[model samples]
Every structure is written in structure tokens, then in C-alpha cells.
Target: MRAVLQRVSEASVTINGKLHSEIQDGLLVLLGITHNDTDEDIEYLVGKITNMRIFSDEAGLMNKSVADVQGSILVVSQFTLHAATKKGNRPSFIAAARPDQAIPLYEKFLFRLESTGTVAVKAGVFGADMKVRLLNDGPVTIVLDSKDKF
Candidate 1:
């Protein structure tokens, strides 16, 4: 599993000109699931995301976690995170989990995240063609890959 976490002042997702979900003063998380991802991966990432100290404190230092600030999350599934481009000009998605295997895990991840009562979570339609818009806060973005935690 991989996630690109962008702290945003506001964020929304639209599908077919209809707004699906939106949030304010939160994080926009672009999540990717690979074939080998498991429940442990979900546990690790969700825990990290909720507790990540990206938000700022009153002293102007980045010391507050999402949990601390009572922020929201706009989670979106992005299978392209695992794209492989080693051999050719075109990127290959062979490392990404197929929809059959990925959807269940993705849903489980959302459920797990919602269990953390500190956040107000919103999500984009899985596997849909989504248009996401956001005003990035602090221009702060972080990339996390479960496979690279060592």
C-alpha cells in the first residue's frame, strides 16, 4: 500500500459533474493498493495517517497530528501509484492489485479509518472517474509506502 497525503484547506471530489464528497481543513489522501497488501498494511498506514504530525501548533511549528486538530480526510483510491516504468516508455500497472482483490481491501481501510473518532472522513467513489480539487495547505505533501517502512 502507498499513500500520497496532502494537507489541504479544502478538498472535493466530483464524478460526472456531481459532487461526491468534500472536506475542509483536512488531508486529501491518494491511496494505492498493491497485490501483496494485507490487513497489517492497512493497520500500519491508517495508524500512521491519523497520528502524523503534519498540522501546525500555535507556536507555528508542525507539531499537531490530524487527531490533535480534529481534521477530516478525503480518501481516494489510486491504483496508479504502483505503476512500474523500468523497461519501457509506458508505465506498467502489473504491481497494482486488480479491482477484484483491491476493492475489498480498500473498503476495509475506510472502515478502519472511520473507527478513529477524531476525524470526519469523506471518500471518493472507488474505481470511478473522479475529478478532485483542493487548496493545498502549507503546500505540504508526504508520500508513504508500506513496502519502504524499513
Candidate 2:
């Protein structure tokens, strides 16, 4: 599992021109899953995402986690994150997990995240063409890959 975390003041997802979900003062998570991803990957990402200290504190230092700020989270599945482009101009999605294998992990991620009870969570429709909009807070963004940790 891999995730791109963007700290945002506000974010929303729209599908077919209809708003699906939205959040305020949170992270817009663009998640990608691979064939080998397991529950362990989900666990690791969730732990880090919820606890990572990226938000600023009153002292103007980056010391507060999303939970500390009582922010929400907006997750969106993005298979394209794993696109491979070394060989040619067209990116190859061979690294991205197929729906048969990825959907379960995707749902697990959301469930695991919500279980934390530390912040509100929302998600875009899996596999749908989603339009996402956000006002990036501090323009802070971080990328994490579960494969890197273990």
C-alpha cells in the first residue's frame, strides 16, 4: 500500500457532478494498493497517518497530528499512483492491484482508519471517476509506502 497525504483546509469529492463526500481541516489521502498488500500494510499506514505530526502548533512548529487538531480525512483510491513510466511515455499500471484484489484492501483501510476514533473520516467512491478539490493547508504533503517499512 502507498499513500500520498496532502494537508488541506478543506476538500471534497464529486462524482458525475454530484458531491460524494467532503472534509474540513484534514488530510486528503490518495491511496494506492498493490497485489501483495495485506492487513499489515493497512495497519501501518493508518497508524502513521493518524499519528504523523504535520500540523502546526500554537508555537508555529509542526507538532500537531491531524487527530490533535480534530480534523477529518478524505480518502480516495488512486490506482495511478503506481504507474510505471521508465520504459515508455505511456505509464504502465501493471503495479496497481486489480479490483478483485484491491477493493477489499481499500475498504479495510477505510474501516481501520475510522476505527481509530481520533477523527472523522470520509471517502470517495472506489473505482469511480471522481473530481477532487482542496485548499491545501501549508501546502504540506507527504508520501508513504507500506512496503518501505516492512
Candidate 3:
């Protein structure tokens, strides 16, 4: 499992010209999954993202977590995050989990994030062609990988 977290003032996901999900003053997370990913990955990321202090406080210091600031979250499934581009011009998606294996984990990740109670969480439909829009806040972005913990 992996995630690219972007702090945003606003974000939304649209499918077929219909808005699917949106949030304000929160983080927009693009999540990727692998076949080996488990519930532990979900647990780890949920904890880290909710507690991450990327938001600034009254002192102008980045001292506030999403929980502290009561911010929302918009999560989008992005298997392309795992694309392997080493060999040639065309990126290989062999490293990414197939939809059968990824969908369940993706849903679980979204559920876990929403359970954090830090903010009002929304999500883009899995396996859908989505158009995402965001107003990045501070342009603060972070990448996380479950494989790197060791």
C-alpha cells in the first residue's frame, strides 16, 4: 500500500461530469494498493495521516494535525502510483494490484480513514475514470509507502 497526501484548501472528484465527492480545508489522498497489502497497512496510514501535523497553528507553525484542525479528507484510488517506469517509455503496471485484489483494500482504506473522526471524509469510486480538482494548500505533499517501514 502507498499514498500520496496533498494538503488542499478544496478538492473534488468528478465522474462523467457529475461530482462524486468533495472536501474543504483538508487533505486529498491518492492511494495505491499492492496484492501484499493487508489491514496493517491501512491501520498504519490511517493513524499517520490523521495525526500528521502539516497544518499551521496560530503561531504560524505547522503544529496542527487534521484532527486538531477538524479538517476533511478526499481519498482517490490511483493504481498508477505503482507504475514501474524503469524499462521503457511505457510504464508497467505489473507492480500494482489487480482490481480484484485492490478494490477490497481500497474500500477498507477509505473506511478506516473515515473512522478516524478527524474530518468529514469523501471518496472517489474505485476503478472509475475520475477527474480530480484541488486547490493545494501550502502545496504541502507527502508520500508514504508501507514497504519502507522496515
Candidate 4:
């Protein structure tokens, strides 16, 4: 599993012109899954993401976690995050997990995130055509890969 985490002032997901999910003062997470990913990956990321102190403190120090600021989170499924572009201009999504293997993990991720009980969580529909919009706060972005935990 991999996630692109963007700190945002506000974010929303619109599908077919209809609003799906939205959040304010939070993290917009684009999550990708690979075939070998397992529950351990979800656990690792949930722990890190929930406790990550990317937000600023009252002293202007980047010391506050999203939960500390009572923020929200919007998760979007983005299979392209795992695209393999080594060989040619056309990026190969062969590394991306198929829906059968990914959807359950995605749902479990969402569930675990919500179970943290600190920040409110919203999610884009799995396998949906989603248009995401966000006002990036501090333009703070972080990339996390489960494979790197080792």
C-alpha cells in the first residue's frame, strides 16, 4: 500500500457532478494498493497517518497532528499511484492491485482510520470516477509506502 498525503484547508470529491465527500482543515489522501499488500500495511499506515504531526502548532512549529487540530480526512482510491514508468513513456499499472484484491483492503483502511476516533473521515467511492478538489494548506505533502517500513 502507498499513500500520497496532502495537507489541505479544504477538499471535496465530486462524482458525475454530484458531491460525494468533503472535508475542511484536513488531509486528502490518495491511496494505492498492490497485490502483495496485506492488513499489516493498513495497520502501519493508519498508525502513522493518525499520529503524523504535519500541521503547525500555535508557535508556528509543525508539531500538531490532524487529531490535535480536530481536522477531517478524505481518502481517495488512486490505482495510478503504483504506476511503473521505468521502461517507457506509457506508465504501466501492472503493479497496481486488481479490484478484487484492493477493494477490501481499501475498505479496511477506511474502517481503521475511522476507528481511530479522533478525526472525522470521509471517502471516495472505490472504483468510481471521482473529481477531487482541494485547497492545499502549506502545500505540505508526504508520500508513504508500506514497503518502506522495513
Clashes of each: 0, 0, 0, 0
TM-score of each model, in listed order: 0.98, 0.98, 0.97, 0.98
In candidate 1, what are the lDDT values of residues 1-150, reduced to their tens digit? 999999999999999999999999989999999999999999999988999999999998999998789899999999999999889799999999999999999999999999978798999989999999999999999999888889
lDDT of 2 at 81: 94
lDDT of 3 by residue, 1-150 (tens): 999999999999999999999999989999999879999999998888898899999998999998788889999999999999989899999989999999999888888887766678899999999999999999899999988887
Model number with the top lDDT:
2
* Sort by lDDT, top down from the best: 2, 4, 1, 3
Q: Which stretches of candidate 2 lie over 4 Å from their true place?
A: none
lDDT of 1: 0.95
In model 3, what are the clashing residue pairs, if there are any?
Answer: none
Candidate 4, residue 150: the lDDT equals 68
For candidate 4, which ten residues in a row score worst on lDDT? 82-91
Residue 23 of model 4: what lDDT?
97
Judge candidate 3 at residue 121 and give its lDDT.
87
By TM-score, the better pick of 1 and 4 is: 4
- Tens digit per residue, CA lDDT, model 2, 28-112: 9999999899999999999999999999999999999999999999999999999999997999999999999999999999999
lDDT of each: 0.95, 0.97, 0.91, 0.96
- Decide which is better by lDDT, 1 or 3: 1
